[model samples]
Target chain A: MNDAAGKNTIERAEPGEVGIVQPRDFVSTGEFVFESGQKLPGFTLRYETYGRLNPARDNAILICHALSGDHHSAGIHTLADRKPGWWNNLIGPGKAVDTNHWFVICSNCLGGCQGSTGPSTINPQTGRVFGMTFPFVTIRDMVRAQKRLIDSLGIESLYAVIGGSMGGMQVLQWGIEYPAFVRKLLPMATTARESAQGIGFNEVGRQAIMQDRDWNHGDYPKNGGPRVGLAIARMMAHITYVSDASMDRKFGRKRTAAESSTAAYTFDAQFEVESYLRYQGEAFINRFDANSYLYITRAIDHFDLAEAHGSLEKAFEKIEAETLVVGFTSDWLFPPEQNREIVLALLREGKRASYAEITTDLGHDSFLLESEELYEIVRGFLK
Target chain B: MNDAAGKNTIERAEPGEVGIVQPRDFVSTGEFVFESGQKLPGFTLRYETYGRLNPARDNAILICHALSGDHHSAGIHTLADRKPGWWNNLIGPGKAVDTNHWFVICSNCLGGCQGSTGPSTINPQTGRVFGMTFPFVTIRDMVRAQKRLIDSLGIESLYAVIGGSMGGMQVLQWGIEYPAFVRKLLPMATTARESAQGIGFNEVGRQAIMQDRDWNHGDYPKNGGPRVGLAIARMMAHITYVSDASMDRKFGRKRTAAESSTAAYTFDAQFEVESYLRYQGEAFINRFDANSYLYITRAIDHFDLAEAHGSLEKAFEKIEAETLVVGFTSDWLFPPEQNREIVLALLREGKRASYAEITTDLGHDSFLLESEELYEIVRGFLK
Candidate 1:
């Protein structure tokens, strides 16, 4: 069925049948004030849900997506679709997240462009799109927006809040901001605060986008965005998502046979890895907004639970949820040490906390990838 | 004295005085052919020499440079100049690469723009800048050009061939291509060949430059080249050059005082690291040519000494030099394992080989940074 926004609603199928959910908008009546002292007047949050909410409404698990991810957390949108949802590997009926048991809620984050009220959203004050005028959003602001969605759904508390990367930031934010409302927390492949090196990388990506002439100071024409800049940004970022070992295993120095039988040695995409990265960049430009990328990444870079709450131990003092902090061994972006910091903080707070460092060459993306180890840990924790 | 091309010759100072040498151009009369089936009619290689050649003419040590480096490896250009040569910290009198004991030769690599025939150099036949027309030059090609320079200097063999990163690649090439000419080889923070991850990074940089509209297919106006693209590329490369631990120590999450006394939650460079990277990018744009960057990075990406010589074991077969492979613990770009690979191969060939894995947080740039351990190693090995 179609919602008022013309977006498709969740399709319920047989217990074992894999099903897709379409994003639906929840328009808030009041203004949402941001940490930057800016406000959005009656913004809309786009979200999707799978499975059925139990009569008690306490079986709801909120799934937070990472950077460049959205409400599509599981299943395929259409039969012809080449790819399933971003976390389809983890959130399927029989997968780690197990939508069959818990009512799953996945929302496009605030400051995101995928059907959410973000930079491309039309400003109520002005007749044009918000462009760069959109208020800056922090992880807390995103969680607050998500909280509003949960409140509207009549869920007093979530069964679990699970996420990786920026999503994991939200999980930590939930633990701090609305501790009582999150019964269980699984923050994977993330840190309490963004590291200097991580910030440096994000800054470079933002600079690449901002420097493009076509960006037009973040007010590019509707159909004409900063493709080159965005592509370059994506190419740079894509490198950080996977480890060196993973790249070696996947693409290596294997040359694209069509480009040059030998070494054409021109600036062409000669290596298979280069070709893969180029494709990622081009594909990213098609799906993502440059301004949204800028805003979301800024939010991530600004994240610091310890800074906000005075200290790491102090940040978890109010947390009532049973937390499971997970990290990927190869995740250089948010190393396991950073995840251990959170676990240690939680332990110091005298809260029930557990940690697992999943060894994988998959890097930061290991949280979403299908692995028996991750699945067992997630299933055991959720149970 | 002024050369025929108006380039200044190296100035001879008093015996004990540490003095900077001016770059002198060595014009090759015959055509210079590239590995990519492209040819240069003739090329002028710009190089700097410090200290005097001994009576035996075998005290010569050729110093190869990494990406973005040039002929000025040590000493200050002028007495009033604030900055000494890039490696002045390690290449002065009584330093790791002592000028007092050795005649040091540093040259702008074959595809370099600094006082050398490169993409920015005018193509005689076309009466235009070579731009993208410059033939692809490999690590072997760079070493070959150095060979010509050495022959012209009447040097029968070099006392040592020393370099790090791309320069290290050149050192390996020298061991295979001109085994008898290089008596000792020190290849630091480098691999026998470029890794998939390394190639991927270089490709991203090249894409960033090529995608810029101002690049104009690598034929941009002399004064109006792709500054933004070049800056972004430099920023990306800079991140790889320094370690995560180093960045944390240097910049941390410390916010820039101007952007926000606290976190403004804005997209602006709130972090000091961002400011540092921006400065690096801007400063790099002032000194480097975009086309030269493209060509040089390509040469690095295409470097595969083992592949050229059939295998790693075979590559070291002709190496007559006593080799020392140096690696920095924190260098993820060219990790210690890669350095160990070379040492292992040399040992397999029954050659005089030693390896030193320097404990440093300086990353790939550790070779240029001050370290007493490295100093002792170099001093002992050279002696």
Candidate 2:
């Protein structure tokens, strides 16, 4: 660990009880010595269990969220007054990821702006916000941090690890970096290695954040720190995430409010797509930190699963996990071909796997949308 | 002609040289008296002379350009020094719409920022930038203006009126609105109607322009007037003009010179895609007015042949012109189906027509690419 040259006031998540074993809830604590040799202290990991964890604790399922999701998978919770997490529709109350029996956990990934060690956290060495000093994180680093979290919880293995889009990417990373820990895997609407298309989109979003005048080299807490930039970035991503057809059916050329006069060509949400994107950008800044948005998206763009394992095929060589890959038909951002390629890679490794391509115009975000068939497929696959 | 409300200046074209002597390059202008009871100014058409106008003035061709193109037909003369215009490869010498035998005329369209009476032109009544005060122009309105230019030049009919994308829309509009004006019509890589999807993209671009701080609601010339917004708008349009593969091959994850560092992670143009977009945006703004971008793109969004002429078939009812419809294999913006629909419309109208679907991954901008085969197909059809 790096030396504690100058210490001052610091705070972190204290060890807490398991708080009763609910199928979709899991929490634990650990420590991580980062690549920079800086030690992260009292890392509290909060996760939720879904479906059944087979007798061996081998049926344990681990889920990872995108940029702004947290551990409270799907249930009634009294912690800090927020609603039951974002993906609750897909993972709770007899849904695809049922809480009837399986053990599911989705911890806030490392470097996340949430309850994770991030730029918002204070540096023990200097007693100041990590800010620009925070060590760069890779998908491997995040998965490694999760591994420590799982180890601390006394969980040796997982039946399946699932994620989509960025989360789907994390799923691939978990499988590539630590094959033995995963017995099953589902990476939906994602790629083994983000193609040039995915990387290009992410890069643009990152630039939007960093170019904001307030960014100040990622050290601008004194100012608002790139909120508008973050909002623009979010708006661009929102367009890519949803399909054109979906956007058309939902928004169209419909004006924000009913047009009162033909002469009144005012600055308003004249089209449905504009209104939707505006809402998306507005809502994003509320829950996400601009700096964290920049950092994590950069990490995603930097991710290369094939390079991580030295070869694309080699990445899956030792994977014994039964894979259930899901892809949405209209996801041009991370199209079906990307997910199909993932399934092909597993097949090349001669691993047990199943693949389903869902027809939907929800685009890269089809995974996040509610579709009965996708739910049915997941339920059966997990069972 | 309704009172000259506020007369200022009148500079007619050099009488003898500009207009063609043959009747083949002509089309009578349709005058649509405005609600304001004013007879709008007429078109001053300019065209090229080809081999013999076939002794019957029947082989005259009309070429049309996309959003930011002009009347230059072919070659690199001191008078024709606009970088050979957009379709240089397909027009000069013995190429498609060959100047060898077919007289080709490509005029600056109505409501264009390019040396035409568009939104930016000074209104004689106010002696100020017309801006939003300029009358709205439809695709058909442009066709009507061009018709006057053709008639004033002594052309009564054309061998063909050919164009791709927005220009294609004009070809279709001309064939329907003024049947006697054309002998053959080609609508290449264009749709019967601008899809809700395409309109959505345009709307997003417009929003970017309007949202720029310097954009004084289309009246901020002294303030540098929305250059950033216009650049961003161009950036978005550039994405639609190319296929994903093209972007990956050309740009991928290359970084800009300013952002690269031995240690620090740079976001500025770090990806080749970023550099390409920035360059496209910067170059685009140099030649385009910010407000003009808004108006022209909206004109495109509002262009739907079927919307104006009822059914796609009815859209071609009175056309006696032979037609050649063409499409690029990779043009998702206006794919093969769009071109096919135009051909189908002509066929239903019993007008002679041919359709060609060129296989290329150059996307909607394929017509602008160096494709000799595409030129050959067009040349043979025109001949």
Candidate 3:
């Protein structure tokens, strides 16, 4: 068995579990330049890896995370951990991105609030949180940072770069920025460019956070800023992440018995869906930084491959990755047409690309949900 | 020419303009009991009417306004008015609602803020603004209050009742509450019951307002409560009112040149869509009351015709009007299926009802927009 720092050498205690994995930090002392021409003297990226790289190092795959995801894409942090990593169901020994056969690497994105250099991270020069001082980071900047991490790990070429939503955008950026370096690309539930509706929704969330008095111009102390605003944003964004049908199936007009007294009308979470959303918002504020949300959503809004490259087809012209773009049938946020558009652009450029659509009621978040259909598609694509 | 108070007898210098209509108030000294058994000792409803009431009083058509709408459904208030009343396109002379042929009566909803006895109005008993003290009012309650106004006007409401969105909910209530009073019922872009997704969105808005410190538990002075919160709510809710395709068509990724500087990333509205939404949010706070928004949305959330009447068919069992429920194809908020569901229940109950689906990119607000198809549908249905 390999004893490398990246490899999960620990024996599995449960089926398909990459048990007892640990996150490591990669601090790059070299200057990093952002897409907006802003520069950082140095940066740290927190990452976790599973399985082992073969002698040839051709089995390395990179996993990118969505808006709220992080480096802990698989495996339990500790034995007492209540939940495994976000993508545990699909990223273990025998899972879709089987750790038994491939070396998997996942990192917190460049402007992420998770264990990465972000707005919440302290500026080494000033010894204060970067806050609004953190430079604008785009999907391209995120991929570029990951490229540095990949280079540090001595992986010259990647077997695949896979992700969904914002992560999917980075996967696309990987194929375009380092065409020959990534042999395969799997992006799901994402668009080449965020739609106007997407921008509008993001703006609402941004406004919610910015308008909060506690936000204090993004200078508030840790865990002390815009709790209500961030929660409200999450609650609203949570709705967009789930399908209307799914919500109806899950919550309907079912009132919370505890809150729905016939005595009087009050502005409380009376409906089960309202209660669930409020809970989601509350839970989110505990983990996420409002400034990071503003930064990340801004990145998403600025992601327009077509606009950047003159045309979507032109953007795919240099892509060497064998791309598989998966779209969810009920994902209204980044609908099937948007996913299909990516493949269509690739095909128009004569690139090796295909599209797979999974029918699910999970909406934009279908990629994170456990689905045998999605599993089969991913497994088969990687194979 | 009839010189009755409801008639717009003034000369119309502009084509199709109702021209200089005036708002009037109806005072009800008797106690008004709400659906939840809460009582209002007395109330005043601000209303406006266009066209003359025929001698038989059967030519009067009751027009209902949506959540943010008011009594001024048609005509210019004065020569200096920047814009005519909302729905002016459809409610003017020779238009779809055709003030030339029908007396159209519209009132600010009972719990509404626009010069109506609502949360923003004074409570005679306490000598303070009703604020959160205003009793919970449902679609049925609003309809009941309007019925009193109609009775005081010496009208039996024999012609028709028409509205969209929240107004549509009220229209349905009118048909059910007084089955024999109304002749034709035209409700568009509304649902028999607000879906879980709908409730979730409403909850987000409520949370935004309630979380605002300036809301002061709904006791803030008139024009001074939760501006930021109310604006954020409006901005988000406005997005739901329009479709993705419509937003794409309207704003796309077009960055506002004045704001899109390459110097640095700022939270200021950069994208045209973002700028537009900010404008929407800001404008909304100037006109809407935060507490009124809470009460109305709660009323909408509580509107469950099926559950309230045991079943949807049971709810439609007493409908004596020839009803036509129009659904907009792009309205994701209250999709065509939801609108069709109402007609389906009516059909199951063997009632005179039909469904019309207007293919448009306007989304839920398609009913309010200028569309020949919708106009034709409304005109033909009313005829």
Candidate 4:
């Protein structure tokens, strides 16, 4: 493995293995101002890079992650890890993203929990965790931060920018905010703006967290957050990630293996789906910060690209990048019709935009799954 | 209006108005045993009737309420009331369910909160609220309880039984368990059994309520239950009640009037849909009992007609009633395909069953709404 000198270098993995890449922190000296008039004195972006940046720096690609995603996008953090990164399926040496040819960078977005400066991070001014005091972040604010990171890397422009769901919102924002800097854009399973149903679901999740007494109005003691409320929030969200068909196929009407044929009729997880959701919720609580979930989901709910630019057509008018917008048939959260709206707007602006509605039972999360069709589409578009 | 003598008279409305039919309680002398082996010493069923039962007593039509419904199926309880009943549009004098032609009965289900012996009711054994101690109720048990009430009214082999959602489950159970009693069955916007997605959503809502510290393990002080948790649960359930199309048409991305163009980015109801849901949740907390909500939803989750009888076809084998199953096109909670499953099973048993898939954007709640097509179908079927 090639080790280039940087701020700090951690252990390297074996050659040919898209293994652990240590994340490095980039602290901005200037204040990070949010659209809401709130500002952070200074902020740090935790990011990881894969592959080598060519001398020309023209091979760089930026990967924006969805809600709850971190900087770890292509490899395991350690050799003992049972699974690699969230997008490891498509972002390896010979994978769809093909890190062998593309120098990929993935950063924990602003107001995220994994490593980026977020609600869980310490406020430089107060010497305490920002908590709810952290200024609410918008997708545009996140893109702006990423722009700073890219500029610092000496990469004038990115070969391509890719993401799905909330990450896709960032990708769209990038195209509008820095049209000349992004060569191509791949925004999958996202809308130009959050829909009413989408906002409603997010609001319920927020309410679930805020209602938790342990949440303490977003000022829970350090490492002591609203686990139960956050778990409930995750459970609610997990249901939306997959389609009804997928749930039926995966769990169906089957009861938990431990549950007897005779109904217990108790408030236990009797159905297999219920058990699965509980497991998912519990697992999420271990990794995600409750306050971060609140901020990020709010960011997503408030995302309306067209609202900022006056109209969708106006939002696309300045987009100079070639775009490939993908949507899944079963994605109720970000339905294919909503994705189509984005492409239609791009087409109306006479921009180089193509649309693909993939038939997948995986729902909105199909963008992160291993699908040959999705792979081919991404490969063709990027090529 | 005709004054029917009962133990108590509440109020009366203007002449020619099907208004203010006071609910009468029928206390079963024997123990009410649940499918889970738990029992209530004696239970009361609060019921309201519209129109007069003829000499033959065969003109009675039973209307089962959905999850949040009560005995108030038609007309206002008092003159000051701005609204009539939940199904007022369809149950008035010359309406589809036509009170002028049929003697209609609507009862609060066995586990319902509104004027029924549910978890909120006092337990004879402990002299305290049943709370979580309430016996687990099933759709079959609810139908059985209704049978006792109908028998008390001297109604044998009633004209018809109709319901939607949980109420529809009761209608199905009535046809299967008391085949000889129900002359016709009208089950709308329901399934033969709860689907995995349905169970998942219900489980999440249950978890939301149970996780609240204020829940006090389902034994919160009188009128001091988990309001926030219950409200969250209501908000979640409300999402499933309507279609994405309906939400978009009703609220879309429109923000609340108070929210400024520039995002305030606060943890408040920014979107109109969010405000609407918050209102729905708050309003529900005023009328619903948390523990009752738990018990009733569990009853709905446990409802599987086919599971009781080896197969769905077997469930319909002994049914003597002419069945008409109606499903809304946009009901993802209980899709048209699920309703068709019931009709298919009935047909497979050589039962006289018809199916109507109404095209509506109202989703699962369409059964309760005023639809011309639905009215025509109900009218023709009852005729």
Tens-digit per-residue lDDT, B1-383, candidate 1: 21221123234343334464566788887888888778877898898877667777878899999999999887667767678678777786767777777888889999899988899999899999999888888888898888888888878899999999999999989888998888999999999878888998898898889999889999888878899999999999999999888999998888888976665666667899999999999999999999999989888888877777788999899899999999999999999989999999899989999999988888889998878898899999999
The full ranking of all candidates by lDDT, starting with the best, is 3, 4, 1, 2
Q: Which rank order by DockQ, best down to worst?
A: 3, 1, 4, 2
Error of 1 at B155 (Å): 0.6
- Tell me the DockQ of each model, to 2 decimals: 0.81, 0.27, 0.83, 0.80
TM-score, one value per model: 0.96, 0.83, 0.98, 0.96
Model 4: pairs clashing at backbone N, Cα or C within 3 Å: none
Which 10 successive residues of model 1 chain A have the least lDDT summed? Answer: A1-10
- As for candidate 2, its interface RMSD to one decimal place is 3.3
Q: After best superposition, candidate 1 residue A147: deviation in angstroms?
A: 0.3
| A1-383: candidate 2 lDDT, tens digit per residue | 00110010011211221222232222333556654455665454445444444456555678888765666555544435355456666765456775545566777776776667777666767877778677766677778888876675557887778888888888887877788788778888887766566666565556556655567788777337766667667777777877667766776555555552443333355555666777877788777777777668767766766756787788888877788899999888777877888888788878887789998877877887778998898888887
Deviation (Å) of A119 in candidate 2: 4.7
lDDT (Cα, tens digit) per residue for candidate 3, span B37-150: 889888999998888888888898889999899999888888999888899888877899887788888999999988889999988888899888889988899999999988
Better of 2 and 4 by TM-score: 4
- Model 4 score (lDDT): 0.86
Model 4 misplaced regions, further than 4 Å: A1-17, B1-17, B261-263
Give candidate 2 misplaced runs (Cα > 4 Å). A1-56, A67-73, A76-84, A114-134, A207-228, A251-257, A260-267, B1-57, B70-74, B77-83, B253-264, B348-351
What docking grade does candidate 2 earn?
acceptable
Error of 3 at A167 (Å): 0.7
Error of 3 at A64 (Å): 0.6
Best by lDDT: 3
Candidate 1, CAPRI quality class derived from DockQ:
high
